[model samples]
Target chain A: MCLSIPAKIISIEGENALVSISGMRMNASLSLLSNAKPGDFVLIHSGFSIEIIDREEAEKTLEIVRHIRPIK
Target chain B: MYPFEQYHSKALCQALVDQIHLMADRPLRFMEVCGGHTMAVRKYGIPSLLPDSIMLLSGPGCPVCVTSSLFIDQAIHLAAYDRMTICTFGDLLRVQGTNGSLEKAKTEGKDIRVVLSGLDALEIARQQPEKKIVLLGIGFETTAPTTAATILTARKEKISNFFVLSAHKLMPPAMEAIISEGIPINGYICPGHVTTITGIAMYKKIVENFGIGCVVSGFEPLDLLQTILMLVRQVKANQPKVEIQYSRAVKPEGNPKAMAIIEEVFETVDEWWRGLGILKASGLKPRDSFQDFDASEVFSLPVYEISEPEACICGDILKGLKKPQDCMLYGKNCTPDNPVGACMVSSEGSCQTHYNYAGIN
Candidate 1:
């Protein structure tokens, strides 16, 4: 249950949200989530949206990737 | 396609290997404390990418693997009662209890249901209102809140038929236990999902106490490799601190609502790990307010003292003292099909991961 994947919320229907990972879509319970909206990336674990991905943190990982240079 | 190939492409992995070769010098051992990380590292052949100087160790990460046999025995005793259905994750079925495994019980006409989530068990309870439904809630922080939320729902709906035998554990205590024993671990690849709930800041205590580098990373291959790079650099610079490589999912503060929900339904209790003896306040039990929803409290269970196979060496494996290969029974008698040790039972277990990726002979 620890294994989680980042999925984008395609639509919100009450407490359940239809999240898409790549192109595959599945409905996850957002009962624990407070105010997650569509287009936000959430960490899906065991059919529950545990955490919404932070944009700045996503950029930080990208920043690290940009800094990495191939060694000689 | 499963996706995320852009981050795990062969070209990117090759470059990461080259970068490690240029950067690394002396030998280092890093223990990945999550089963998910262990599977990812072995599945992607990440070990082959690194120089021989670097080592990766797997800890007691799998909840199914580390759950004390007494817990399983208790579940089996519950299953024996007529008009009772035991719900659990698929990983818990083949686990051997004091007398026999859950699969064996199922074969003997016991109703054991494998569920995807704690809510699924609640659903079963709702459908079969007459039967006593017990969800075997076993996991780390990642799963406890989900079970908690389900129990709260059951209480609100006035459903007394549902109860949870919670076997959830916290990660930091186990980390502290390992470090205190002088395991010689240089750094830790902290669990991403657990950190997502508890936050990266919670690990500061461990880093401060042990003076070892602790970092969180995602499951993607590039993310794991990048964290390894960060860990090695920390060792080289003699800078030991907590960092988050998986900041996208994990923040410094963590998910407050999730943590609050876990606090609502369950409280920390002394938990017995399969290999490691009972760690203080390491496990979660139902709070007194939610006593009616606790399966163990509602129903009496007899605990059994079951020792692991003498030759298994799972205890040493969990403590990071011995690799799966170090055990004589690793492949010869402890195959996943017929697991003598708990470590060989789950897909995330180091032995199972190694056996699946590279043929264990």
Candidate 2:
């Protein structure tokens, strides 16, 4: 049951943050994360924001995959 | 486009598959150590795209699948108490114990609640202060931190009725156990979510000790294919190292705050895995400071000796020794609607995933 989705934080109030996954909004706890803020994307697992997603790193991975030429 | 949808691009996945097909020259057996990875691989038909030389085995990753029957039996026993409410994940509802499942117990009017998160269980405790709430904690490191957080919240809010029957397991020790048991695995597709909390250090240790490559992967088509391609490259170069293909969510050091919560609330001990048996320091339990929240300590429950069904090969399937097809009851008797074993019960489980996506394009 380790399935988690990347959710963007819409707002934060104390240890709880309102995160939007796709179009659905839910409350996620920021107790596990130190620097999560509004508009930042975080991985939500079991009602908690486990980690903040690194957008730069994500784009870099996609960019690297985009450049991989298929072997003939 | 949604930020996570980029990893699901069909074109990127095909490219990685093409690269894997071109690079996989020799026979290599790789095992994915996460149930989420297993589901994604089957759902995306990843094996259909790969060369026959590259074999992928599902590891003992599904927490529900690996949980011993005794744990289920104990939970069932606890459910018999009139003043007790057993809060568990939805997947655990149908998993059969020695006598019956929690679903069966619920039908017989037991106080069983299906909670999505441990915090939901705490909320149940807050709502029903007259009854005791015992959360059936089952998962790897990806989930343990959340349970730890729930316990801390219970203490902070003075929720005395909340308890956790922790069946939480660690991924690295189980990985090490599989290797030490002489499983013929060349590389590993590590659990992406677990690594988000534990980081790559444990995987680095696995690579150093067993000289096998590992790739922490996300649960998507492109992610699995890319991870497989990375592992293939490592095998081709004879260089075993740990890589993070899911670097967007997982970092090298992982989530230190999450780790800190887990360390504060729980301690490792020998745990029983259905297939792997008891592995040392593989299970998590609430520490002495949190003993009041520990279900095992809070209640003196009777130990019930339980055995796996004689016909089910879930244990073998978990060890990567057999496939779901190898089990005679896989389709005939053990459909998801009526699961005969733990593997067929959880959606992330190999048997259930195989049953659902079998022969799919």
Candidate 3:
């Protein structure tokens, strides 16, 4: 029940925003976010965008994972 | 590939698995206190890849699974009233109370509706001015904010017919209850989405108070593997702290706007969980100011004594003491199609997840 998916905001109208997730577009409420705008990737949970996904941090995490070599 | 899809790379998952196998030399038990993680762990076949010494236990995190039977009974009782519509998430429809389920009531000519979000319940209220719309608000911190937003919207629009029967709960108290139960837990993989709203401060308290390692993790194969590796590293070094493996979505401070809305609308109260019993201040209810929208307050309903089904060990499974297969009725009588217990009803539930992915039947 706590499942949330990452989506990109397509446009904003009042407190609701049109978000695109893997090419599927839907409306998400921006009430839980303070400064959400178009083009921002956010975690959509139960119709509300809970948090803005940080792109740099995401890349950094992948970079760290890529550096993990198998222990010989 | 999308940015999130990279976290599911098989190579990255293998690397983390290798690292975990190498480092985890001793027996270590870790619990994931989120239903999403429970499903992800099993769906990704994480246990088969990990070392034999590391045991992953599913804690009481599935909101639908942990909701007390009395609440369901009360909701069912409310559905019996004429001109009263009970709106809830789809998962709650099949969950059995002592007497019957919402799905059963629906078949008997009750006005029960399955809604995707709390706002949809409010919309129903707007459409049917004569009927009273009661939204069964069930979820943790991740979903409570949406319910709060719905209530705020209802208040703004002056929707008097709208109400919420809040079964929303907080995560930390339940985690503390589990730790206090003297379970031999070495580390914790915290709920990532809940942390996105509540932040890491509560986890820091857990680490400080209990002296255990905790990593807030995302629900992906690579993410779960990396989190296990992080936990193993913490146990090996004997230095326990709270870390965020899902930093891309979860922040240390969390979403302040969401917190403020929850604070304004709801207040902490004692709530009943299925297996864990009552934890002090673990549940959320509308504040006295919003009593008009509070379903429990608006409707004077009889509280029914809860009676869990016999032979169902969902309680022990939820407390991390037993697996789904431990129950005699697990695969034989209690399957997802016909769930005898609450744990078997929700897809995110440990029993249901195990049945679906583990192929233990």
lDDT of each: 0.87, 0.92, 0.93
Q: Fnat per model, in the order given? A: 0.60, 0.84, 0.86
lDDT of 2 at B24: 88
Instruction: Provide per-model DockQ scores.
Output: 0.59, 0.80, 0.81
Model 1 chain B: worst 10 consecutive residues (lDDT sum): B1-10
Expressed as tens digits, the lDDT of each residue in B88-127 for candidate 1 is 9998898887678898999999999999888889999999
- The interface root mean square deviation of candidate 2 comes to 1.3
Q: Which stretches of candidate 1 lie over 4 Å from their true place?
A: B1-4
lDDT of 2 at B146: 97
Task: Tell me the docking grade of candidate 2.
Answer: high
Question: Candidate 3 lDDT, tens digit per residue, B1-361?
Answer: 1567888888888889889988989999999999999999999899999889999999999999999888999998888777999999998899998888999999999999998889888889999999999999999999999999999999999999999999999999999999999988999999999999999999887799999899999988988999999999999999999999999999999898999999999999999887889999999999999999998998888988988988999998999999999999998899999899999999999999999998665
Model 3 chain B poorest 10 in a row by lDDT: B1-10
CAPRI level of candidate 3 = high
TM-score, prediction 3: 0.98
Alpha carbon deviation, residue B153, candidate 3 (Å): 0.9
